[model samples]
Target: MSDLEATKTRYEVLGPLLDERLLRLWAAREARAIGSGGAYQVAAATGMSLKAIQTGLGELDLLEALPDGLPLTPVPGRRSNGQRSQPRVRLPGGGRKWTEDKDPTILPALELLLADEVAGDPMGRQRWVRSSLRHLSERLAAQGHSASPTTVSRLLKGLGFSQKSNKRKLGAVGRCPERDAQFLYIAAQRQTFTAAGLPIVSVDTKKKELIGNFRNGGRSWCRSAPEVDEHDFPSKAVCQAVPFGVYDVTKNAGFVVVGTSYNTPQFAVSAIARWWQAEGRDAYPGADRLLILADGGGGNGSRAGAWKVNLQERLCNRHRLTVTVCHYPPGCSKWNPVEHRLFSQISKNWEGQPLRSLDLMLGYIRGTTTRTGLRVSAELDDATYPKGQKVTRDDLGKVSFKPHADCPIRNYTISPQIADQQA
Candidate 1:
């Protein structure tokens, strides 16, 4: 048979079994045996480019010239004997060049694109690119850097970047200058109150949940996922649920009052009062002083006059306890113990489960437990709390209120009117 026909027959017999390196080397050996115009003939027969055959022939020459006593290193593929092959597939720096190496300008250009779009903690090692991979690739191409989305992604990973969604890290606009100071003050107060055996409770109104078969956020291990309403329209709900939580810092217990009414100052204070009556008072018996850690912008807000008024009348006067309320700085509510410690657990427990009714939600809250021995109690507060109930200056004056020397607007104490008068 002719050389081309013979080469084709040999390849057809062993082509399926041979890998890239072995195929190239076998073709080179056949070409060398065929003499002049052999490489071109082999390329045409095997459909391998002439460059690959030349590379294989060069490798064969290097193998022959190897100094004696140098151990033959095993490569990745197997030989005809079913043993590891003893030849390097490619020489050093023989494969395709890295995108970064080939186009040095690519990395710098990518960094430039990310400089404006990157969002993460400046001190943190992990950073995320805001632009999509395709968009970034297009931008890179526009800058004369030819790169695919996959290449851009790899480059980003190499540059300590990753895909990340928007995080709620940015604080609210017009952040309080005394934000850090207020946090420190709260910590100090907690220490003091904890030492003195006073009842320290973190209070906050949780996000209002629509009461119905509404879709929840997370997954649950169940036989099947419980179906919920497609759209979360407020009007479709039976009523909104306002869960005002009171988390005991010392006891590691949570008390949540699910209010059907408006989340007014009265509702918030009443929830606190309910918790104290049910759990707090018994947990810290003989504790006359109550330290309340609250956020600065809700029902029990630092600027809410009615919150102070309700705290004085409902909590202090009714229970004959001195209430010290420390408000976390604006936009820093997540730091409140009630948020991360209590509310987060409840949300996790009820995750992906439709809150078909108020009872189901309360059950979920009550069932939530943590590895650190967290216990929770929940109850429905069917009382009507009318919103827009203004607390006039006279009403505020009646409460025995004393602001702290440091961050007075964010920290204050309300004593029982009778106790203040008697003193």
Candidate 2:
């Protein structure tokens, strides 16, 4: 074969396996082997232009001089007047320039505009001025700096500022000293349960969704977007869906029981009971102890009297199982595994789709899956759970429970009092 034909053969063998840089280097090396002005010959054989072959040869020469690990581009002598070192795809400094960089005084002007300096007030009224981006842009223009609202927004972000909405995360009682301690104790309890082959579950009630043709919070890919009611009035809603989720920490499984009525303690315990009867009992046969992780407020709150009483009556007494409860600190419900693992998946499953009927909602929950083998089962609880069902102190005394020494109010275990069951 001719030298050109030999070069073609080498390319055909190594082309698929080699990256762009390696391929270029290989081509240049092959050209060097064929003697002086061999770049023209290699280009003719490979269908690469003579200019590209010459560039490749230049790259090879640079590689010999360059340190082993330095990247091919950004060579010392190759750069010219802010242009890229090499003649390739991307230009040097090719991204959108910061507005603040374009006009240095724009940031300081914005800070002045936002600053609250009342002429006479000692405290200066308020430090934050919530003005529109367009208004700010106009003010900047008046100060001899030309900028659009979009550019102003970009400048603001560069200066560590952003458009923020009201956050309701701060509850009635702010951060507690016992928060970290409770979390650590809960973690320890979970580890103990998991090691002992006992069930550990995170339980929480998902936000109540308005039933019927109401506008959901997200969008889905469809030929055409589904039409929904413009205004979401409670009168127009068919009913509200209260989804109580139970997430199994060990197995990565979820169970959601939807209720049509009030989300009372009775309803919460009932959901747990349903999950135990349907899935838990079969999964862990003869398992006597159940560990529950819950939020500090709402239907299943640590302070809720009805929640414990219902647990005693519906779960402990009826099922003959010891129920250990751990309540997450106030305003920390978002950390609950059920909130993220179960409810988040459910929301994503039925995004932009109207939950017109109970069956549709249940189907969405059941179909929810994750890459980490999350299996979910959902059921509708049509039972009438009456609100305002009070659990007196006398009723609480009847249930036998031992508070953990670490955090008494937050961690406790209610053992079944049945003599035969304990035996």
Candidate 3:
């Protein structure tokens, strides 16, 4: 057979069950299969991890060829079975013909960047990363490879090798008692048949505001002339709208409090009270308890001083209902509904519009709309938001909590609609 025919024969052996991901991997180091060793070596040579290599091997539909059990070849020269042992398939690194050519410029520049020595100074490091593409381009040309630096930056980015560290962290592995308990609680709730019974509410405070007239995001008409700033004038810190936003899973509707100070127990309880009175009470009529999914940070945080006990007291005092709050792990705040459902739309609606005045800001917020048929209409309550509102020991001690304390935190219900599953 000709060289081209031999190459075709090699790929034909790769099973049909092999998906695109595995096919691409095998195609990378494909060669004549007659004496080719399988995917493990190919993966190593190509710099893929062992797990990836194993997945590629798993796609092979070699059922017709592979025996049910392997026969031991007792001696070096011979097989115990009547049929001869399968030939040791020696694979070559040069696989299929070029389906697509990689951007020649980017690869070489990336190589140069990875191989280069870092300067000790921070400024020098930043400058080098920005300018490396230009230098690498020249090197590539000298080495008979054509590429631009922009192409290199794009390639590195695709590889997830950022100039700065990606701050996201993975959840803990193995025995994490607290996390395991949270998972069990959520699982138990899901087993409930009633929609209102298993309430899952996502709660969070929106991004903090810079208490002054600052450049807001979204597009606006570009300034005809640049306005001069007076450095001599005292800069004012803008008071933040510490909005406590919540989303009910069953209703698919959200409620929020545009408070200036929400770090205290009173303010936090007030937001929940507003929510229970306005949203949860009418919708889930029989529900007596509320389940809140809040972020680990901000005023609604689980770590915040006396937050849970204080909230429980408040719930008992006002609504005669029990309240339980769940916190999403750190850096997982993006999963909160308020960020996507409420704040994202608000940002989009007010894009490029300067939050020049409180009325304008309030108008922008109240006017936010979504194609999903949800419109966020907000109110600007111009009331004094006192800071450092206390939730003292005496305050909590004065109120009574339900069930006298022997309940499993997970098995406990916040809403009144919680019915026995067997019922």
Candidate 4:
């Protein structure tokens, strides 16, 4: 066939089978088959550049004349034929190397730049910095490295850096020296209560929800996303739902009392009392004591005198059971089992679903359950609870309780004040 006809034949036969690399090799093979000046004809037929055809021809020549008849060892991933089996989109170890790799001092310079923003003890293992990637990139550039914010981000990830939100896990600004000791003590107390077949519950107020068509913070599958009011103004709300949860630690059951009123000590105690009447009494029959694990702050806070007084008057007096209260160290409410085990599930259940009415909020809470056999029951406490109700010195004196030897402020027991028995 003529050189033009040979090139046309090669294109028709190999066009579908060959990629860029193979096509170049095939064109070189066709050029040789058609004899002299055939490279020009193949290039015209295949639309391959003349330089590519010449390079392929050179590779074929080199392969044909191997040194001392050494066995042809083709590239590991390439086909058996001398032709390269893959396109050269990228060469080996090609493209731009990471800026940190190119400049060894970039990461070290970044650390030095973030030294002032590092939180916690400098010598401590856990260190955190609060700086934006753009700021970091600028700082890197100032230190004589060419890095954009994107490059800085990639380098930071390689150096085990990540964007982290502020965790409330940091101990109080003025942290107690006995913080860890208190945690250990609380754990031991819980173990003791569990062993004795006594009832133990973690108590905490889930973030209050505004009852109205407001934007909740998650997604639900529907035909279309629900439209909510643009503004989340409290004035536009019908009422706020204050959920005080009592999570029975052993039973994996939850009792959430949705109060339309303030989250006072009275309301906190009321929720526990309601749990006892509804579920706790049956769950722990003949139990002499009740253990409450709570945060160090809030309505039932360790420092709240009214919290103690109300516990004395409401829970202890009503049930006639010795109530042992253990408050987690300041800024450690996240560790409370109620927060993860119960409240989280409830929040997830109602997420993205607007609470247009108090009843809807209560219904959502009650319907919350988990595959791990978590059963939650919710009640609406419409009774108004007065806030800032102070407990008098006389009332405080009437309360009977003993502080634990370890961490007195965090661990305490409030007993039913039996006037006749005490007398």
| Per-model CA lDDT versus the true structure | 0.84, 0.80, 0.52, 0.81
Off by over 4 Å in 1: 1-171, 419-423
Scored by lDDT, model 3 comes in at 0.52
lDDT: which candidate is best?
1
lDDT of 3 at 90: 25
Q: Going through the candidates in order, what is the number of backbone clashes in each? A: 0, 0, 19, 0
Better of 1 and 2 by lDDT: 1
Residue 375 displacement (Å), model 4: 1.1
Looking at model 3, report the run of 10 residues with the lowest lDDT sum: 118-127
Q: What is residue 241's positional error in candidate 4, in angstroms?
A: 1.1
Better candidate by TM-score, 2 or 4: 2
Per-model TM against the reference: 0.61, 0.63, 0.49, 0.62
Best of the candidates, TM-score:
2
Provide the lDDT at 76 for model 3. 24
The regions of model 2 sitting more than 4 angstroms off are 1-173, 419-423
lDDT of 4 by residue, 119-143 (tens): 3321112334457889888877777
Candidates sorted on lDDT, descending: 1, 4, 2, 3
Error of 3 at 374 (Å): 2.6
lDDT of 4 at 284: 90
The alpha-carbon deviation from the true structure for residue 418 of candidate 1, after best TM-score superposition, in angstroms, is 1.4
lDDT of 2 by residue, 293-382 (tens): 998888998988899888988899889889999998886676677876677778878888988878888899899998879999999988
